[model samples]
Target chain A: MKKIYLALAVFSAVAIVIGSTVLSVSYEPLDEVAERMNLTGENLLGSPFPEYTIPGFPCWAGGIISGLVGGIIVFAIIRLLMKVGEDGGN
Target chain B: MHIPDGYLSNKVWLTCYAISLPIIAFAYIRLKRKMGKMEVPLFSALTATVFALQMVNYPLGPGGTTGHLIGTPMLAIIFGPDAGIVGLSVILFIQALLFGDGGITTYGANTLNMAITASLVSFYSYLLFRRAFKGEKGRVISGGLAGWLGIVSAALLCGLELGLSRATFGYGLNITIPVMGISHAVLGLVEGVITGFAVYAFGKYKPELFSR
Candidate 1:
């Protein structure tokens, strides 16, 4: 039963993204057809449908490297804080 | 969100795992220390509740952002940080495996972001606020503040991670980071309220939970 809820949530989220994308695509061409109803390009990209393309290898590479490095830094900081707290007995 | 397959480079997932291992081990040790055989049901039930709640997502404009209210920090305030981490990780794991909310590979990163960070931040902030207020209200306020801060903090850190990935991959950090960050901030505010209320209510009803 709970699993069903989870599935529904994930499905709806995906649907929302897809619906937004469809709206954006539909609107993108409409501007050319009807400039007066000009729903701005920025709005199409920013809200509802985020502008996402298949990122090239560069984006993937950067994200991986950054995620690992940042994770380490955060881990170290958290460790230090924990050690201090343990020593302080709090 | 679950990191979809191929959404992130292998290095990112590896790094997240590398960092998460020790923290997870520590959490396990902490849980063992506090565990009572009878409490398993209570914990599992709580985990289910968190998972179910987090699954519900309200729409965000054209894009839909839906999920539980994200109350990890509040859990930590009442159940100690390490135990809090355990509870959160369990929910994330269940979501990934059962519901497919997050990607399998991205589990490490997602756990680190949602559970590890929020739990610790809430624990520490609560301590600080408890000292500042020097009373019961202090505890309540701390719970809410920590809950709010924990969610926002996770959102910001997630943005930073995304931005860095964009930079490393040459995806144009200028575009991805701001977009992710702004969306999360708006979402986080709503999440924060939910988290804050959860913590405040728990503290009121079960003050004994926060006493420790």
Candidate 2:
């Protein structure tokens, strides 16, 4: 069961990467619409923010890496929060 | 959909913030009151997993625009609706603040659409479907359908919000609604499949997670 879960996770990851790559390079109508609608803008920090993309990697690869990193960060934060809550409760 | 900062006017975004803030506070309070300490790690882990999954964007037909999994249905199924709201809000907040995937100004709108609307819709939809069917098969089907409908519902709400912003931002309902609706409808299928498989796998492997 664990192996199956692992396999599914890997397969899903691979599929995501490949799909993202194709989508990144392909012509996106929504993006065009957004552009037409003038939805793109700067980040909250006052810096220019563009759509999801990486200079050296494909969009999918970048998404995968960033997502994993984000997950780790969130997991750590949640665990820390839990610890703090536990301490407070005690 | 991660609406950028300039996309929504102050009136629109502020209204969204006003609406979403109270709901978020309510969700937090409910989570604190209802959930045990042991559930914290599982909730956090699942939230993080959903955050990661949202990053995986698949193409919608020949258009270059991509759509990602909403994961609200799966989260709601596992942790219930309130937790789903909290989890998705956290993910969206982080993405906007740290990754700049979404705009901070428009964060409220995004939260309302994805976290509140999608979560509740998926949760209730799943419950309805689950009652209609029986056993493990029922749960899987319900989850998939919920996921699909949840995303579409969220997209529809987003379109409405965008359309409302027309007076301030100048983009009308016709433009935003159809575009968001069509793309998300297609993407919802992928969400459905993923949700179904996930429910099935989790049901088979870890029945404890489903225990309330």
Candidate 3:
């Protein structure tokens, strides 16, 4: 019980630090490392690399929401999956 | 690292899917067998924790680029690799489907690098080092090295994938492998420290989480 609270407190603190752009500096996505180089995409089959960052929510908001919402979703789904497994994949 | 779409050639991506699918299935099977004691609260907490942590991109010194935690190492160190793999797979799935952080096409590759490989390496390395060392301080040090090794191994695998994706990424093995490997080697230090602290914290609070 104490561990849970500690974990949540730590998680929320991390979420706030990373989610708030003011607190954390943003870095370029790793995939784009190629873009910064002299190499051109024309050599590859897909000429233009795609951008796949999160949409809509800011980092902090998304972090908090996912932590809260994802916890419930993951628990329910994992439980359901276990039940199905016990039922022989019915 | 999350390899986006169009970064991997069909051959590379497909091969990754083929290789990763079986391993993930095995992890799932293992997870199910132990589901009763699976510790969903901790797993979910860590999953969301890592999900948010992955978003925090730290600058990689003067390289004009950045890196973030792969995190499976810490999870593996605490809860064993099987749970670590399962949890990371879930995080990557959400990141791809909802956040667009990774690609559906590249998921296999991403999972292969960040989850499966990272957890395995982290877990085994910890075991190996723990056996070689003793006491509380040694355990924390072992955890740190295991974390470093895990992320570095993932980076190396990512480099290999990108290197193989010369037909798709326009970078040959020489370019992609070294960049990914070297940069990650540096970034892995941070992983090592975090993993060590995680080991310390867990040992102090939830010692039961550590597997025998």
TM-score (C-alpha) between model 3 and the true structure: 0.85
Backbone clash count for every predicted candidate, in the order shown: 16, 5, 1
Which runs of model 3 end up more than 4 angstroms from their true locations? A23-29, A37-90, B35-38
In candidate 3, position B105 carries an lDDT of: 88
For DockQ, the strongest prediction is: 2
Record all residue pairs in model 3 with backbone atoms less than 3 Å apart, i.e. clashing: A19-A60
Compared with the true structure, what per-residue lDDT tens digits does model 2 show for residues B68-99? 78788787777788888888888887778666
Fill in the DockQ of model 1. 0.03
RMSD of 3: 4.2
Shift in Å, residue A43, candidate 2 = 2.5
TM-scores for every candidate against the unseen true structure: 0.63, 0.85, 0.85
For model 2 the local lDDT of residue B16 reads: 96
Worst 10 residues of 2 chain B by lDDT: B55-64
DockQ each: 0.03, 0.38, 0.27
lDDT tens string, model 1, B1-212?
A: 43433444567767877877689778967765575444444344444445434533455422453333565776677667886787777666544543344556667777787888888887898788778875656665666677767765665555555445542333445654554456556656656565556566556655656667
Model 1 sits at an interface RMSD, in angstroms, of: 14.5
